[model samples]
Target: MAILPICIYGQPVLHTLAEVVTEFDKELHRLIADMHETTVAAPGVGLAAPQIGIGKRIFVWNYADQDEAPAIGVAINPELWIIPPEPGQADPEHEAEGCLSFPGERFELRRSAAAKLRAQDADGKWFEISATGWFARIMQHEYDHLNGYIYVDRLTGYAHNEAMRIKRKRNWGKPGLSWTPGIDSLEG
Candidate 1:
């Protein structure tokens, strides 16, 4: 398995909705393996096929305890539905997030603390799941990739401006720098 070069922002492949994988063949297995290797190499919790320029409806994520190694798995032709934040679950705060595509850059973005998703396993077996906490965020973020959405789009108000500023600065040769948007600017 090899670590694939991730497609960064502005890549046309990333903006296109991924095609569904209909066959669970050796090639599919190999792609999942390569994706797992790539995700670990990048030290990310999850990854999607579009990030690697495959444009397939596939993603992998694991939320096992930090002490335990990640359980690498794949979702083939997955579907996701966002669950509305319930009473007393309002205002999920922003979390600092990084993407393999956006190397050396990070942003503060708010995401749902919970989600409901359904997908097939590598063997084409169906599964339904509900996730919460950081795992939920990871699922939602990666799921967005399948739909041609990036984490930058999840940011609101000043956070969006801050991410753009840092993105520009990095393109202009700024490195090893971190950006933090003012919390007061976040919308509820």
Candidate 2:
């Protein structure tokens, strides 16, 4: 397996919505393998195709609790169904997160506590899974990339403040602060 170069935040490919994989061909499999290799090399829990300059709807993630060994797998053409937060439902707490695309820049982001997802496996077999906690957060983050969304878009309040801090550090000494308007705002 090869380690692909992850496209950074300013790369145009990252902002483009990925195309669904119509055929589970050798190339698709190879891309998944390369993505896994790259993510593992970066010591990241998840990665998406667009992050690696591929405009395909695919992602790889592994989320095993402390006790169990991590289980890594691929998702192709994934779909998500978010359960509505109940009345007075507590917002999910912020967690420090790092993207394969933005190495050495970690920030806090809040996401749903749980999510229901449907996607195909490496063999193009369909499956549905419900995830919560860290697993859920990782899945949601990677899935967002397929739809041209990044983790920074989900931050709120103090979480947004923390993200700005990290962003400034990452872009220290740069001419001007580069920001994505809608994404930079804390309001969701």
Please give me the total number of clashing residue pairs in predicted model 2.
0
Write down the lDDT that model 2 would get: 0.72
Model 1 is weakest, by summed lDDT over 10 consecutive residues, at 179-188
| Residue-wise C-alpha lDDT for candidate 1, range 119-140, written one tens digit per residue | 9988999987777777777878
CA lDDT of each candidate?
A: 0.72, 0.72
Off by over 4 Å in 2: 66-70, 84-94, 157-188
Tens-digit lDDT string for candidate 2 (61-142): 8656622223787888999877653444233445677776555555666567778778999889998878877777787889
Off by over 4 Å in 1: 66-70, 85-94, 172-188
